[model samples]
Structure formats: structure tokens, C-alpha cells
Target: MATDKHCKNELAAPSADQCMDHYGCIYENNHLITLMVDPADGSIVDANRAACSFYGYRLREFRKLLITDLNGGQEDDTGSFLDRALPGGKYRGNQVFHEHHRLASGQHIDVEIHTGAMRILGRDCVYTVIHDISERMRSEKRLRESEERYRDLVELCPEAILVYSGGTILFANQRTEKLFGIVKEELLGRSIDDFFIEKPLSSSEYNKLKAMSGIKDSFRIEQRFIRRHDRRVFDLDISGVPITYNETATLQLVCRDITQKKKETERAVRLQEQRHAVGFPLEDKAVLDKLYIPANTLSGDFFIFHRISDYEVLGIIGDVAGKGISAALSISALRVMFMDSLHSGLAPVEILQDLNRRAIEHMGEDYIAGCCFHFDFNRGMMKAAAAGINEFMYKPGGGEGMRITVKGTPLGMFAGSTFEQTAIPFQAGDRFCFYSDGMELLFSSDELCREYEYLQGKIAGSVLQDDCTWLSLLIT
Candidate 1:
């Protein structure tokens, strides 16, 4: 019975050699410091070679102590590992840093302990992995401090800084929000076009920005934007820079609100209009009527009458493409060219050809349609040259009218084209009307003929709805 009892005890004990053989492979090759601890008394049950080497201890020495002996806390403290590994408790990312543990010879080493709960040997236990991250932690702290300093600098910047990514405003500085009259929360996740009253920047501008990819020379432009609070238009001078953040390309914009400047500009335009109305009266008796219509705040159509040597008069009517300030600028340039060519004593056809050549040279590719008519009263003849413009109407008596056709293309188009000059004998009570296409929309060819017949016998006032100038000369 004694032998049988000894045999049963031997069977109950685990084979140490077999257990070592099975776990030796894991102990030698594993990177993590794997350890198993007792659940009931928090004793060290088993530790791999990695754990012994990481904690500055031999496996045999570690087995002699409880898990709490290695903890920096006192023996009664129970340590954080026991608390986390209790049945039904959660194992969060709990870590302890600079924890000192004793070795066999009483030497101490600093370590970082990461703990999690698991089952070991068919019982509830705590598994821990140790790491020596003292140097890595120092590096991370320095990087975080540098980032904070850079953030502070950006916050104190005076210019309105806007950071955009993927068509949404990701970040905005205090000045940016204040200029747009919107809080940062509202501005984020919104597109730049949301506040812009004018059209968004053109595709060409966007392409140019993509090509530049850095700070460019300052360019001045007028922009219209709406405030969030009142929806009022505010002109702005905006500058932008390109930057890379988090491996993504983005744009940073700095804006200045120029509302006062816009107000001053409008006031100046009104004053100039008043001054022009006062100084330049429509006083030429040869001009029966004139009309002006601007497609926008400014016009591209221009008409002028110059009394050349009392008997001879020159009338010019022209239209440039586009609208607003660009067209206005082109018209001003054309006015200078027209006056220069006329004063040089060139014939009507020669004057138009010279003007076309100069305009093409200066404007480059953009063209304008115009007509010049010279009425030589002393010779009883009216000579006119048309370039790309519609036919001119010459009304004789008894509802008879003839159309003068253009023989050349619009100015600024071809390198060389001939302009045909047509001369008509000036008779008494002959009416000549020169106008833009805007006038033709109101009167068709048949309707104009009827009007001319009606006007042959009677003097009647006509309502012209376009930019028109009619010169009716009655030879005595």
C-alpha cells in the first residue's frame, strides 16, 4: 500500500524535463517578456527567459518570490497587477514606468511593466510584458514640446491664416474667423466658395497655384465676399501659400478685408460721372439723338463725334468684347488710338486700317468691330469705311434707303485686309444713322423702312432703346 501511494503521488506531479522541453522553445525565441503569476496569492508561477533577462533576474531566483516582491510598492500594497487580474476585471492599457526590482545580489534596475489578464495553467492569472523604453520616452517628450511651440507661433500670427484640405477648411486662425465673421466651428468643414460673393478662382489660377507650390510674388486682385452675420459684400485682398501637412498638400490663405476701399472707389466713380456730365455736354447740333446702355457697371460701346474743320465731321462707333473694367480699359486704349489716327489726316479707310493694325499689335488676338464715317459738307459727299460692323443705313426721300456693306473682317483679326470706302452724294434732308447691334433688336429692316417712310413727310420724335447716334444733316 505504501508503494502504491508513492506511485499515485508520482503520477500527480508534472514531469519537469517534459515541461521544460515543451516551453524551452518559447522562452528562448520570444521577443516579449512573458510571465505568469498565481491568481490566489499573487505569487510568481512561471517566467520565460525573456522575462528573467528583462527584469535583471534569473528564472530560479524569480520563482522564490511573489509577484508583488518585484513591484516598487510595499509588501502590503498588493500591486496593480493583482487588482487588474481579479476575476471579471478589465485589463486596460495600464503601465508603470521607472519601476525598480531587486536581483539575486540585491542590484536594482529600472523597467516599464505593461500588464494584462489571462488564463495560465487552467487558472486565472496576470500576464505581464516588460520593456526598457527610457530613451524612447525622452525623444517623444522633446518632439511634443517642439510641436507645441510651433502651434503657439501660428496662433499669434497677425494675418488671417486659413488651412484647407480636400475642399474643406480644416483649420482657421482667430483673425481668419473674425474677418469672415464666423466662428471656427462654423467655418470648418465648409468650402472656400461659401463666403465668396464673386465667382471662385478660375481653373487656370488653381493650376498655377499647384505648379508654384510655394510663396509667390504678391498679386493684387479685387474679391467680393459675404459676411455670415449680415450677408454684406466685403472686398478683400487675399494672398495664399502652399504647404504639406500629414503627407497631404494644402493651401494657406491670408486675407485682408477692403470694404472701406470699395466704398471709396464707388464714391469716386459717382463723383467722376457727375463731373463728366457737367463738363462734357451733348452739344453737337449735327447729332439728332444719342443713347447709351452699359451691360454692367461699365460699358464696352463707345461713340464720338468730332467736328473736323467746321464743314467736315467724323463720327465713330465701336464695340469691344467682354464687360466691366477690362472692356472699359480696352475702350480707353481704343479712344486714344482713334483720336491719334484721326488727327493724322488719314482717309476714313486708312484711319480704320491703321487703328486695326495698332489694336492687334497692342491687344494681341482680341478684336473690335468699328465704323468711321466722314461727311465732307463742302464737297457734298459723305465717305464711310466699315470694318466687321453691320451695314449703315442711308435714307433718301420717299422711303428709299440703301445699306452700305462691309468688305473686311473685324479689326485685330487678320494681318492684312482691305477696307472698301463707299461715297454717296449728299442731298438736302438726308438722314444718316450709325448705331450698334443693340439698336437693330428694336427695329427690323422692314420696320426701319416703314419708320423712314413715316418720317419722310413729318418730323416726329422716336424712342431709341439702344446706344445709338443719329446724325441728320439738311443741306441748305
Candidate 2:
């Protein structure tokens, strides 16, 4: 019966006297600051206990002050605010939020004020509900400072940095602008599709990144990125990760420019292609048949054969110590030295001695393992020298193949190193196969003595699994 009467008195009462008393009861003890003000003249007519406590002023003291007195800034803004809030004596606008207000102690604080029109005791008034937002404003300011610090930190990074959400780029660093040839403003708010040219970035791709399995949730891709203005494609090494940024899920990407490295690789491929022609000469089928494959754009294994005379042909198979373009370059220097002294009528050991001197002068300390041989058809014999190299020969005249292990210092290692020469008589039924270390892995020790077709079957494709070379000096 008491609840029914209380509800009836609070909700059903329509008289101004009862409504004013109910409103007073609600606002007087409310936690939020409340004030009744005369809108026409910006005069406070009444003040709640919360308002007095918040502003450090009693009701009589507050009634003497205007609403503009509470505003921290000049009264100009308050005038405009009141004009907007109470246009034509009606409160139709949104509450003025994030406004700076002052307390009676002169301390400034952030506030949000709700304004609404009402009539109390036959007089027009506005009830103001004030919310202090000092804590929220301080948090937002700190967050802004933290964001600025992070941005400043990545600004010095050489690689481009980007932060995105849902495939939409939200933040891009200065390097990102420099990389994409676009301004910071242009990169911001752009989609991932604008930069990547390999495949279009969509929701599915973003989801895949988010769903990537790992504690850190990261992935890397080496591909291409297109510049927006010039449409220039850059070889890019890109990595992405799912991270928490500003309490929201985000994807951060770091892109590095590898355009120069890509160009160098392409040039190496061209050099390997050109070197393939001269590296193996098929002009003399009666001499030898050759096979060569590079593990990469540059071959570490190389060979060259040239007929020194009508009866004498000199051949050398070498495996440089390392892989890639560095080894390729060293071998190229070795080739130049060998060819320069080829017709000098020097012996096989003397030729290697001279090549060694040239290699040390030009090719640094990159050691080479190679075998040099001079085949003499007229003499029916082969004079070979090994410089830290091994050569395999299947001599039917001797019943089995013997591996020729050369005992000499590698080229470019020392100045006085000598190549040990061996002279073996050439028999018609004998076959010789020279293979690099990489090629040896594909076949067993016994298989190296078998026919070359046996080894070809193990090769998956035309390309060798490693930097490899094969030279068969068949005396048919």
C-alpha cells in the first residue's frame, strides 16, 4: 500500500507545487551536481547540496553568481553556449560536453553539463545537471601522449611501419610515406590494396593473419609493393603481426626495401645464363659430354675445356669454396687467369701455379678445390694434376674405378703450393667421370662409377638440387 502511494505521488502528480517538491527531493541529495538557473539572464535561482559541495559554495552564494561565472573561460563562450542550448527559449540542442569549468577555489576541471527547460513557481528556469570529467580527460590526455611517443619512436625506423585494423590503414609512419611515394595524409585511411600488387588484400586475407597460429601471431612474405603515384614496384620483405593497439585488435606491418638485392639477383641469373655457354663446350663430342646445374642464380661449380693442340686438350673442373655470386665472381677471375696463360705452352702444373698467383692477387682468400688435366690423344695418355681436388675414374683395364684424391694446398691459400701431377695411360675401354661435391650427394660411391643415366634418374627436374657439375671424358 505504501509503494502504490509513493509511485502515485512521484509519477501521477501533475500540480506544480507537488512537482517542485518532488524535483527538489530528487536533486537536493543527488550525487550529480544540480542547479536551477534563470536562462534569460544566466542567473542561478537555486542550488542542490551536490552543487554546493562540488563548487565549494552554499546555496545563497551560488544564487548570487551567473552560469558564466562557473565557466573557466571568458563569458563569450557561455553566451554562445546558452544561445545554442536555449534558442527561442527552448532546450533543443545537445548538452554542452567536454567544457572547462571552474570551482569556487579557482581550480579548473573538465565538465559535461545537461540543460533542460522547466517552469518552477510560474517562473521560467533551466535545470543544469553537471558531470565532472576530470579523470576521463586526464586518461585521454595520457593516451594521446603515449600514442605520440610510440609514433615518434617508429618515425626514426628505416623500414616503413604501418598499423591497420580490418584491412583499413589507420596509421603510417614517415618512412612509409617515403617508401610509397605518398604523403602521410594520403597513406592514412588508405586500404592495404593500394600498396600490395602480388594479390589483392581483402577481408579473408586479414582474417587469415588474425587467425594465424602461434603465441605471437605473425607472418612474413617477400613480394612486391607498388608506389601509388608512380606505380613503381618495389621488392618488399614484409612481416605482419596481430597486436593490441589502444585496446583494439590491430595488424602492424613492417616493410623493407630489397629492390637492389633483387636487381643483383637478376643480374646474377643473366651472368649464370651467359656463363653456361662458355663454361661447358660441346664442340668436341669426341672429347667429352658435360652437365651443369646451379643451386642458385650463381654457380659455385664450374668447368672449362679447350683444345690446346691437335693431340692435346686441357680441361679443369673446379668447385669454389662458397656459394652464390661471390664464388661465381672468384671462378670468373680464375677463368680469366687460366685463359690468358692457356696458349703460353705452360705445363698443367705450371698453368695452375700461375692461376694460383693470379687468384691470390685478385680473388682474396677464397680457396678452390679443382683438378686440371691435359688429354693427349696422340700419346694415348692423360696427364692430370689435382689441387686439393678429387676425380673419379672407372678404369675397366684395372677392374674397378679408383677415386683420384689430389694432395695439394687449395688455390689462393699459399704462394708456394704445388699441384701433384699424375700420368695415366688412356685405354679405349675406360671411362672417366668428374663430379662436384654437390653432385656426389645424389649418388652413392658405387653409383658414381656407373653410367651417367643412372644418376640422371635421381634428379627430380632439369635443375640440380645443389650447385653441381658433371664432365665425362669418354675415350671411345
Candidate 3:
């Protein structure tokens, strides 16, 4: 009702004919105390009837009083109020509720005031409406105390908690600030992305998280964050929770720094590497062509080539069960045992038996699939032992390819998985190819077979004769 009367007055000029109609209207007859002040001197220019009655002063007495008298002689108070309520900027809403004023009776009261600059008598002046807000101020003080108590509980929490909005850090507790090496004041206006080592997040990821169902519960993310001082790397296990503040959506982040544990893990990996280097360089002039790619940093595939005599060569290729550094070390131990047995002049079958015995002795329950061959160039014969891996192909005297079939269980798989030795005759121009499962696993079985056939056709016309290596052996 007050707003409607105010609008009518704003649309029509005041005249004697409309004076009686406006007398009891809500705008001119509101209970709020209204005052007009001269901008040049902070003097009380005019006071409405309600203002005169509310401040316990007559209109004649109020005209002689300066506006500063009601403000308890704070010299800069008037200047601050004018700056906030000038033509382009005016104080609005509850922001005006914090000002304190004294009445003519010298009794202080908390008041809510709305103010704006307006033209009066062809000169600039300020118009203000004041409302008593003593009960509202008391309620607000109690609410602030409750919030302070809750904040204290949040600060004492062990988990690192942070509140953020509009990409800026809003609030952080002691644990969070200490972990990040930042002060509360310093982090307030800074973007949260500034503390991350990687790109903060894609727009799609942000939207996905915002739209996720049941977001109030919890969610986890693994990310990299930068330390505040030296910018060192740290891994963060972040838990996000959604909250509303000031009617806007905000995120509460709980982060755990895992830098020390990560460093210890890396150190343990390097030590494992040093221990597995015990069985290096097993043979000389054997031309071992090997390519290793581990799903992890460590692998379980193993290969060894050794010369038993000046005219005889022994080759072994195997893949151990499982993966990781432990499996790789197991394969290394098996290789050492096989090399030791071969150097003692053991037959192909006996060598496999001894290797299996050693594997059973050292390995827990893991097993290895392998094939071994002893080639004698002088006698033009080859002795081979197969266990688990039996499919083989050879080209004798550079003639048509032939497949050799041998059968046995993998070593360490059973208590006594025996192996059999098979012999094959060779010629001067014969070529032999040996491989592990990884070689076939490089491409699909069909793709690899097709590539192999294509390589065979290419080799027919090529004159390149280089030492046998992984890729080079395919060329003539």
C-alpha cells in the first residue's frame, strides 16, 4: 500500500486540489520517520511530522539541530553515508540496518535506514526513511553466535575442509590452510585451480559432477595438486560434497595429501630393480633379439641364449604366470637356473627337468610356459624340449616350412611335469625362428599370420643379410 501511494505521488505534481487526498495516503502518512538533509553542510533541512514526533522534538527545535548531533559527533560518518547514497549509488536493503543513531532525548537506538540523493528546491539533498530494528538486531546477533559455534566445530575436525564458489576460495579451516601452506586471507580471492598441478577440470566434467544424482552424500576423485611454497607435486584424494550458501551452489572439498607414501612406494620399486639384476648377460655371441613391454613397469617375460660349445647354441624363451615386479623376479631366477644347468652339459630333457625342479623349489604356486633348443651346426641336428608352448615352425635347407609338435605341462604347474626331447635334421641354408607368446600377442593372431606371410614374400626378392634381430631377421 505504501508503494502504491508512493508511485501515485511520483507520477503527479503536488497541488492544493490533491492535498486533502494525499493527507491520509500511505506514502505521506507512513509510520516511518523521514528526514531531509542539506548536502553542503550536513544540516537538518526538513523533518516530516512522524520524524518530529519519533525523535521527541518539535519541528521548530529540529530545524536548529544539525544532522551530526544524532550521530554522536562522528565527523566522518556523514561523509561515508553520502558516498554510499549518491546519485548513481544508493544504500539498499538490510545493509542500512547497521547504523546507530541517538534521539533528541539522548537515548541510542539501532535503526534500519534507506537513503537516496534527490533534488529539493533546485539543489541537491538526501532523503532517508528510518525504521527501528532493535528486535531484528537481537535475533541476528544470536544467529551469528550459533554460526560461530558451528564454525569452531568445523575447524577442529581432522578432515581438511574447504568451501568454494565462483572458482574462488571462500573459506578454509586451519588444517586445510596449513596443508596447502596458504593463509586464509591470501587464499580467499584466489582461484581454486591455481593450486592444482594439472588443468583444473574440463567444462563437461564440471557439468557432470553438478548433475550427478545424490550428490549430497559423497564422491571421490584422484588428482594432482601443487604445494603453495615450492610448487612440489602432491597427490590428492579429494571427496566432494555439495552445499548451498547465500542461495548459490558451492562445493565443499576434503583433501588428503599422499606425497610421502607415494615417494616411499617409488623407492621400493627402485630397490626391486637392483635385486633382479643378478642374472644379466647369460651368454656371448648368441644374438639374443628381445623386445619387452610390460603392462606395468615390471614384466614376467624372459629370454636367454647361451653357447654350450664352439659349434652348439642353446636358446630359451618363456613367459611366467602373472605380472608385476614379483613375477619378473621369478622369471629371472628361473633363467639363472636354466643357464647353470646348460653349462654343465645337461641333455635337453634333463635340462628341462632340472629347471622345473628349481622352479618348484623357489616359486610359490606360479608357473612358466617355455621351449628350449640345442642346435649343433657340425652334426646338422637339433635337440629341442617343449613344455606348454609346442607350436613351432622351421625352414630346413631354405626349403618349404615345416611345423614341429612337442608336448608337456608348464614347469612349476604340477609336482613332476616332465618334458620330452625331439630331434630334427638341418642343412647349411636352414633358418630357424623361435618366439614367446608376446610375439603373437603383438597383433591379433590372424593379423600377425598375414603379416608373417607378407614378410616371407618380401624376403624372397630382398638381398639384405644382416645379423638376426627382432625386426631385421624378417628381411633376408
TM-score per candidate, chains pooled: 0.49, 0.60, 0.45
Clashing pairs in 2: none
Q: After superposition, how far is residue 166 of candidate 3 from its true place, in Å?
A: 9.7
Please, what is the whole-model Cα lDDT of each candidate in the order they appear? 0.65, 0.74, 0.64
Q: Judged by TM-score, which candidate is best?
A: 2
List ranges where model 2 is wrong by over 4 Å: 1-158, 164-166, 199-220, 225-231, 239-252, 278-287, 341-345, 397-399, 461-465
lDDT score, candidate 3, position 310:
70
In terms of lDDT, the poorest run of 10 residues in model 2 is 206-215
lDDT of model 3 at position 21: 63
| Cα lDDT of model 1 by residue, 1-476, tens digit | 99999999988856767666765686557888777777667788778877777667787877787877876545334435566455245455444434555555676655566666665345766676777665667666676777576557667988677777666787778777677777777888887667654535354444432343444454445566666457777777767666654445766666777688667546644542452233112234243533454434555667666767767777677777766556666777887888888756647898888888888889776688788888777787888888877577777755466666767677888878778888888766676666666556665554343443343322224443333322334333
Residue 142 error, candidate 1, Å: 23
- Candidate 1 vs. truth: CA RMSD? 12.7
User: 360-407, model 3: which lDDT tens digit per residue?
Assistant: 888867888888877776777778888776655565553665666788
Say which candidate scores most in lDDT: 2
